[model samples]
Target chain A: MTASASERLTLVARPLDRQVASLSALAIVLALVDAALPTPLPGVKPGLANIVTLLALYRLGFAAAVWVSLLRVLGAALLMGSMLTPGFFLSLAGALSSLMLLAPASRLSRRLFGPVSLSLIAAYGHIGGQLLLARLWLIPSDGILYFVPAFALAALITGTVNGLLAARLLRRWPSSKH
Target chain B: MRLIRPGDVAVFTLAALTCGLVVWACWTQSPARTLSIRQGGALWREVSLLHNARYHVAGPLGDTVVRVEDGRARIESDPSPRQYCVGQGWLEHAGQSAICLPNATSITLEGARAYDSLSF
Candidate 1:
């Protein structure tokens, strides 16, 4: 039996909807895990959910990736109960900057550096945003220096992990050839 | 394609250098012997001849009390959901500070003299 064009479109739309829903769910889970995970050092987070952002960038393109990044930050802030404070603003700034840098990088270099490098770039961008926001909004004078070591440490650890995870996910669900 | 470009290297190098300068500044600053905390128009707490010690300040309302003794410091405040500051542990060195936002309290250690005295 030959399916009508509209029916085929519906079939396609259904998977797309499911993907969006599951991706959003994944973002929230990552945020919870990020808040719950204990670190030996204070102010350091693993950024485990960044893998979703990278994956989205590769598979769903830039707009979808941006949405994922924003959702993750918002979800994390809500989970941590820092939603309306300086911490939320800081996270938002970091997410925006990180995605801004990553979206372009993913488009240009996904074939070469793969997910790990993208993750590293995104991590660096996020820290850069936080530092900039701290200098601008919170402590204008010396607060920026306080978290340098911790932020650097986070970037190193989280970027590596996110990159590795992104690679694995990509391999599992290889991009469908058009 | 090389993901790490020359520009990335340069930016990272500059960042490293800047970080080194900050660490150096932190280490060289001396400890303050006398300090004062002010809220609004009144003195909140004033301490003189603050010795090198560790102190812990904890309370339900985020009101932080500073305990400094023999190179140990502890900060106790209403644990916000994140608890980032609580996890920061005791800050013992001079030129260090811990902030508890829930209580709007901040503690800083400085060189062993008042700012006016240093000017003389």
Candidate 2:
């Protein structure tokens, strides 16, 4: 006997729901880690949550990836108690801009450079957005300069880590689960 | 994936170059010997520096005191709980600034004869 159309839809929907729930869980965990970790630089973050972003990009489409990214930023901000401050706005700008750049780049180059490359590109975009906001709004003068090196370093480290992790996940799960 | 894109390289280089320029500009600015302290949007005290010029800044959180001497500057404030600005040293250049978040205070050093006094 052949399965009905609605049955197949339900099958697909269940996996999608599971995937979204897992992604949300990953985001919350990363946010907690970010707040708890100790770093030498003030206002500098490791952005470990980006690994989830890479996973979402590989498994889901750009829309799903974007949703994950936005939810991560907003949820992290709320959890960190920086939701309404200038820092929150700055982070929001950076996260959105990075996602905007990463979504397109991931679609274009997901096959060649794969996860690692996409992660680096996204991290770079994140730093770029932060620097732009710092120059344009926060400090407005030389503030961009102060953050450039630190941001660059962060992009390199976080991108590489997230990229490698994503690559590992993709290798382990070749077929998209959701 | 790629080593770096041309645009990314260009932008990064530009940012680095701009930082160098700002550091240079800040280094060349004049030293200030007087400091003005403010609290709650009102001027609190203006102190004149003598020998040593080492200042201990204590005030309500986010209050700023700008100390200018010769072409140098030192800022003390309560800015937020991080206290990143308090840890910063003096600034004696056109593009150098120290901000205290807890105190909502900022100190910038401007060159005496520079074209842009308002640059920082």
Give the Cα lDDT of each candidate. Answer: 0.66, 0.65
Candidate 1 residue A157 C-alpha distance from true site, Å: 2.0
RMSD of each: 15.5, 14.5
Taking the tens digit of each residue's C-alpha lDDT, what string does model 2 give over B1-120?
Answer: 333334444444454464465555444434444445444446555555433353445556523445555546676444567768667766544445566655655554443443333443
Which regions of candidate 2 fall more than 4 Å away from where they truly are? Answer: A1-14, B1-120
Top-lDDT candidate index = 1
Docking class of 2: incorrect
The digit string of per-residue lDDT tens for model 2 on A1-178 reads 9886777443455677677667967977886798689977755677777778878877876677777878877887787888878878777787888888886676563334566667777777777887787789888875356456666666777776677777777667766455
Write one digit per residue (lDDT tens) for candidate 1, span A43-158: 47888788888877778777778878888788778778898799889889888999889867766633445677677778888888988888887879654565666677568667
- For model 1, residues B1-95, the per-residue Cα lDDT tens digits are 33344444444455455446655554444444444443333456655534643333444464455565554454554345665556766655545
- Lowest-sum lDDT 10-residue window in model 2 chain B: B111-120
Q: On a 0 to 100 scale, what is the lDDT of residue A34 in model 1?
A: 82
Candidate 2, DockQ score (0 to 1): 0.04
